[model samples]
Target: MEQDWTAVGDALRARLDELGMTMTDLATKSGVSLTTVRELVHVLNTRRRQPRTLASLSAALGWPGEHLGSVLRGRPTSEPSGFGSLASVHSELQDLRQRVEALERAVRRTD
Candidate 1:
């Protein structure tokens, strides 16, 4: 099967937007490096990623573990089923926490 790096990048970017998450957030959440996340998000690398890398990203994105792998292989995968509202609430809380942390850091820096 052929791999479509562009599709992977598009999906990653779109998911990040949909989650209102920055690439840094994804890297932290996925335990993946920011550099790798940037490469994937920007499609800077056309090389195939390890299954574990894709799985980590998928999990961090609140998707099925194989979601990204499927995309890489040009297979169709659906958005996560069930617990959508719960997941959204969780994601929102996480985003809010990150914002608060950033604000706190800014305040600290100004002091």
Candidate 2:
């Protein structure tokens, strides 16, 4: 099923408001680029986002990344019972991956 990008944008905007966060803040906290965050929340762009991008954003928002990813991908967002711990582990792993990638980029810049 085709995902509703506008709805996704609206949901993101609502979450941002609830969190008292600006787009720039979300970008910085999520480790996502400002341009990507703007595009995601601006409602005019229909471009699909990468799974890792959604995962990073969800993790920053203190949400389960897989649930957010499922919603974005138009899949059912339900998880089986006892999956919460796994989701938490997944989010932590994603965070670690992001840190590693950032470090790798910084090291590359020094090369």
TM-score of each: 0.79, 0.63
Question: Against the correct fold, how does model 2 do in TM-score?
Answer: 0.63
Deviation of model 1 at 10, angstroms: 0.4
Predicted candidate 1 versus true structure: per-residue lDDT over 1-111, tens digit per residue: 799888999999988898878999899999999999999989998786789999999889888899999999999987645654566678889878988999999999999
Cα deviation in Å at residue 104, candidate 2? Answer: 30
Give the clashing residue pairs of candidate 2, or none: none
Backbone atom clashes (below 3 Å) for every candidate = 0, 0
Runs in model 1 deviating more than 4 A are 80-85, 97-111
Q: What does candidate 2's lDDT look like per residue over 1-111, in tens digits?
A: 677777668767876776656888789988999988898888667776778988887776656676566766677766567565564565467668998999999999999
